[model samples]
Target chain A: MTDELDRDLLLEFAKAEQPLKSKEFTTNVMRETQILGNRKKRSLWLYGLVLLALCILFAGPLVKLGTMFAIGFISPLVSFENPWLATLTMPVNNIASIVVAMLIGGRFIWKKASQ
Target chain B: MNNYQETSEAGIINLARTGDPRAFEELVHRRQSIIRNLMRRLCNDVTLAEDLAQQVFLKVWQSIAQLSRVNAFDGWLKRIAINTWLQYLRKNDAMRNSLEFNDTVYVPPPGSNGSVAMDLDKALLVLPEQVRTCVVLAYHEGMSHPEISEAIELPLGTVKSHINRGAKKVTEMLAAYKQPTAGEKV
Candidate 1:
């Protein structure tokens, strides 16, 4: 029967010797793992240091400077009552309209060129 | 000269999870032979198989912490090995894409003098990669079709067909070596 044939053949295959083990296999694997582990540890330390630096920066004069810039940037958009706010909003709006116009023109030209 | 031999696999896995190189090394030493054998059969290139086996162990070392079941270590290791082999095949798409049939000849042992198992091993190398992998897993590894499907990430139908086809080929190749019965002469 076909089953018998398959069984016999498979049995023969199963008798094969296991692939010969390399003498240095374990040593090489260990060495690589150690190197990988060290790299991971160093990366973690670097991340920690960057986080600490960011915390220190945010706690210092950087926070005040950032807050001042944010308020100045947002004040014109939220309300343009002061002359300085009008000045800031005018240039920003003009630049924004110019960029939007350029984008639309570029898209039309690109579509024509592509076609 | 290492004390690693005294430790259990679970103990070693714990150490490896904690990034202990010696413990991982011990784990490698214990399991490398089976993994290498499986790789050798799957790839049919001893050097490539060895390299892939090393990669499998490296993966195990790197991702041991992600394994949810400690007792499923063998299955986990096999899954990693199979995935690594599949990835290699995927990257070298040309190997699978080629229409060329493997033409390696299977020379049967002369007059039953040599080991049939040795001949079978050589014959196995001649099979197409997918078929050989299915046959080896089903027979040598004692895996069922469904298990092989999941492990190899092949469809169940394809796995079944590959096993059937592979078994038939092996049987045909080894038919000459089949022993004669009482009425038949060798």
Candidate 2:
């Protein structure tokens, strides 16, 4: 009863026709998608290049700096007669470097957050 | 994709995803009338419905690849069309709010048959947005309860409740209109 009435009304509503879009709409959508796709590709390439440059600039230098600092500072303590002390202090030096790096990273993030 | 090649509708979607403008055009041609009708019923405005229908197709073109199941294209497209209109309505909330606030009276235009159709439309307009959407999708679009729930992202129980409430309201309005007023002579 109610279902039949609802169904009839729905059919009547569905039978109503809407105006068609202009022919240009299809071409316009394709063009817009193409433009967006191109922009995405270019931006991805740019990000890849920037990442490569950052790795080149930072990776080798950071590793070298870490190695040099570890050897320069820890080698002296390790060269001493007390090898156990040197071993213990070697871990301390590594921990200290890691702590310093984390502090600097944290401060940078904090600054950005505050802004 | 070729699995659905025998089905022209699925084939059209596959081609459209692969950037075949003609295939996409065919898909649009086939479904435009239905989409337009759905839009008109959902929005209650013919011109806006047409514009939204075009926007729906444009979105379909742009996001075709993201659609994996070709068979469910109609449901997917309908969801897009519904969301597009919902977004438009949300953007124009101020206008709707003002209209509602100023127009408290629900005066029926002359020559209304006091029939089920006019009563239902009037009753639907007064429903909450979510409920109205469910009713429209269920009744107007011929979607099953599950389909309506999925399209509108509502729970099945909620969808059923909406339909029930919407139907009750329409029935009540119709019944009220049928009864004679105190001042009116038989």
Candidate 3:
């Protein structure tokens, strides 16, 4: 239902009129870009350093946890056990070992499958 | 840059892709007007338009490396501009669910062609932001519905309806001006 008059009016308004142009516009954009660039550089360095520090700080706990899990996993495979415990407390020891092995194995499979 | 002064837009884009600030600044200078004008009309606010323009350029600079085709620069830049404005509109919750055909009558100057355009500009400000965008892009920028849908990230049907409703509203509003005032000398 649009008429010629409406079309003409819109075209007239559409004609480019740069009333807002100023040298400051370009300068402001460039300045903002410069500030952002500097901020990005600083943030990248900070993030990298923070990540490295976190890994270093957690290395001991992470290694200890991994070793504990690895021992549980290996005990099932190796079947190495103290002779005295095997004789006197064989059932309880076996149950504890089985529980540990299942927990560790399930966790390892979940992590690997997710990755 | 003096070296980049006569370079084509594609050449400048390539340089900007590689982190040349001068080239990016040059790109901004070249495309600033169209982007600013589109934003100004879309927002109907000069200050917001300028702010949006800056954001569009900043986004373009940030994502310049992703633009594999140099010829798609205009389309890409416009999409960013439209998206930025749409985002602003969304954040403000300003999209009107229904078009309000305001009763303010435009009294066009007698025998003057420019008055129609001037009054139309004023009339445009009263439109809902989404319709105003579609109207401006369709009539002013001469964009097709598919192009507009792609740029605005709206469905094609939605773009068509907005353009139709917007144009109808504007035409209806302007229809009032064509009638002679009661006391005017014939």
Candidate 4:
């Protein structure tokens, strides 16, 4: 006779498994839930906090710069009859937009990467 | 979660369902091993098993309010464990069709050979994710085929076939560990 068993022996083995003992398993899970369970709310508050700070820090300067920019470009175009409106249309505003976009994108990427 | 009071498991689960942190922590302590072991069998990686176990518990904590009966905790926990594993597989695209998936041969853990139980675990590792899941629920968890279908959200017939096919494959895989009849020789 060939080597064989009369029963599906895998059952006994399956039941015989001893769970791997983990130290502080409950503690670790509890810690993760506390830290991460509210991640969506936390991330929302984080972005809001960052945006609020950016607004607080740069609002005055940005407003001042914007007004100066508008006056400089529009007034010049109006008075000088400048044909280079296309050229003047973008540069500074685009830089400011790019800066804001980078701040938001950088924060997002940093948060995701860290997680 | 600080207050320590010993109570019946159902009481703790009820308190946990009501968002009582201490009760929740107690529940976690009681059930963590079962979930952890189930995850370990599912993934076959210690770290990922622990991570998935954590996710399972986290989901339990977040949705314990939705659990209708405290007595149903075991089934609820097993369902969560399976879903957590399934999500991980789907997220990683780790469980593609067998022919298209890069099959990772099971490397038997040290001191795990010879014994049928150990060999069975190695055999389980050889199965595709969905099939292995059905097999594990049936054999390891002692769940009925219909129960497995409900747990894993597969059709009844599909679950039955997966268990059948998986059981046969595992038996074949373990044939090497079979004991010899009286006159049989190496």
Q: B24-127 in candidate 1: lDDT tens per residue?
A: 77788889888888887777777798789989988998798887777888888988987888888778773365322354556554456556545565667667
For all candidates in order, the CA lDDT equals: 0.74, 0.66, 0.74, 0.73
**lDDT by residue for model 3 over A69-92, one digit each (tens)?**
766644433343687655665444
Task: Write model 2 residue lDDT over B14-131, tens digit each, in one string.
Answer: 8888977667766776677677767756665656766787788878888888998988888788788877877776787621442121123344443445644445556556655666
Overall local distance difference test of candidate 1: 0.74
* Candidate 4: regions farther than 4 A off: A1-10, A37-115, B1-5, B99-118, B150-155, B178-186
The candidate that achieves the highest DockQ relative to the unseen native structure? 1
Residue A94 Cα positional deviation in candidate 2, in Å, after optimal superposition = 19
Runs with alpha carbons beyond 4 Å of true place in candidate 1: A1-5, A17-19, A41-62, A65-115, B94-101, B105-118, B175-186
Could you tell me which residue pairs clash in candidate 3? none
Model 3 C-alpha lDDT per residue in residues B101-171, reported as the tens digit of each score: 44453444444445544556656766777788878888766777887788777788988888887787777
Q: State in Å the error of residue B140, model 1.
A: 2.6
| Model 1 docking tier (incorrect/acceptable/medium/high) | acceptable
Regions of candidate 3 where Cα sits further than 4 Å from its true position: A1-10, A13-22, A66-115, B103-120, B147-158, B168-186
Write candidate 4's Cα lDDT for A24-105 as tens digits. 8988987887777589688999999999999999999999999987565443222224547645654534545556679999
Worst 10 residues of 2 chain A by lDDT: A1-10
Q: Candidate 1, DockQ to 2 decimals?
A: 0.29
